[model samples]
Target: MELTTPTGASILVNLADDFIHGFAKMKVKRIGYGAGQSDMDFPNVLKLYLGEASGRRFNHDEITLLETNIDTATGETMGYLFEQLFEEGALDVVLVPCIMKKNRPGHILKVMCNQADVEQLTALIMEETGTLGVRVMPHAHRLTLSRRIVEKKVVVGDREFKVRFKVAFDSAGVIAFERAEFEDLRRISKKTGLSLRKVREELKS
Candidate 1:
């Protein structure tokens, strides 16, 4: 299948012939349906489900971590590699400075992704960095909080814009913290000609 973005960039994805499958752990609370106009042999409708994560109550599936040490790669090359990894469905990418063999300074590039995308991401890393081999730790368990995005409007100067906040909750459904997205705050600061600190203060109040 081919997917195209708004900027005309395209991505080609292959599917298995036997079955199409995806894994998600969620606690479904409500389900709704929308009817389609097209009449066909089967029901023409769309299903929408709303739910929260199962949280600590259930055993969650593990994610894969791919790591490689690079001593000869340049910073610019690593930066480009990170962008590609994100575009290819990496959950997270981290680069840490460390000392390799022979007391040489280098970086440890770690990538987190699901099992489905491990092969593709690993191949991209190898092709981009020329790393002889990558270390893979499959089935690494992750503890994540349940989170959702909420919008709040803040007035800066004579204009107002909505800022999205990430609200995280505990397993018992209690809110842990809510913080405005940094990119949103930065955009507000640029438009209002205010310091980032000022924008944050205003949002807080």
Candidate 2:
């Protein structure tokens, strides 16, 4: 299928053969069915359901957590590892400073990714960081919010620029939180010769 916007931009979508696909996230409360056209060999019907989801909206999925302690890797090397993990489809990466068993100062790197990407990411960690072993905790469930980015126009000084905002909604369809993207604010501040705080406050107003 193809879709075109007023500005002449286009989007193309291709579906798999012999399969139906849809994307939706909702809570199921009540269900009802309706019968259609009686002349067919198979029953034709439509199912309807209703529900209420309050608080935060989230989806359940399993993820893998990979961790390792590195006392020898340089700060630059660790930074590169972080970039590599993200490039390899890691959901999140975190580093925590710690003291090892031998009283050596070290840092613990934790990587979160989908179960399918575990093998590749784990191998990359070993190859890049040269860690003797990586501990993997599979079957970890996560609840993630549904999020989207919207372009907003903000004025700084005498000029206007488009800024991206992240909007989050709760399960009850209420806006849980909304904030301007930091990168946009930083860029605007540099261009307008304003402090980061001033730019942020101006955008908020």
Candidate 3:
């Protein structure tokens, strides 16, 4: 019975530092698994565990990056693709303008997503841009901070508005950064007849 393939063995050898006979108590953050192709009596799957050991401070994760080059897509097509990708659970999508071969202006579409979403997102990119191939870079390490939304009450002239701000905290529970939601700001600006820049200034003050 072959339990581990060459790739699996190599991963274990390179990644594992210690081995134990019994399980230890820990907090599990996430669980991921890959399906195996075998007709076995038992469930054939390779599972990966992400956990926080005792007294651990920060959180770490891995994500998949998918990129493709598009020279024929119009602005409207790019906008639709962005909406679809985000609706399909993409963590972030960015388009970088570049010059392709023959001095053709193009854009590089980059998508960040979880490993589970790699397939669908790659397909979406191909379908949207008509690209024959999409580059997949899996297991990109990521360090993330804890984030929460805080509601703030702001008085703009005679109007009082409640705005939501996203606050990020470091491992030591100190604030790293805070950003107001742009949609909220845009709405406030439209209603108050103030320019978006003026609204931002009011928030800063």
lDDT of each candidate versus the true structure: 0.83, 0.81, 0.88
Q: What's the true lDDT of residue 102 in model 1?
A: 98
Q: After superposition, which runs of candidate 3 have C-alpha atoms over 4 Å from their true positions? A: 1-58
- Give per-residue lDDT, candidate 3, residue 175: 80
Runs off by more than 4 Å, candidate 2:
1-54
lDDT of 3 at 141: 85
Query: Which scores greater on lDDT, model 1 or model 3?
Result: 3
Sort order, TM-score high to low: 2, 3, 1
State which candidate has the highest lDDT: 3
Best by TM-score: 2
In angstroms, the error of model 2 at 58 is 2.5
Compose the digit string of candidate 2's lDDT tens values, residues 81-110.
999999999999999999998899899999
**Candidate 2 local lDDT, residue 13:** 34
Q: In candidate 1, where is summed lDDT lowest over 10 consecutive residues?
A: 10-19
Q: Which stretches of candidate 1 lie over 4 Å from their true place?
A: 1-61
lDDT of 1 by residue, 117-164 (tens): 988998999898888889998579876778899998878767889999
Error of 3 at 174 (Å): 1.4
Q: After superposition, how far is residue 136 of candidate 2 from its true place, in Å?
A: 1.0
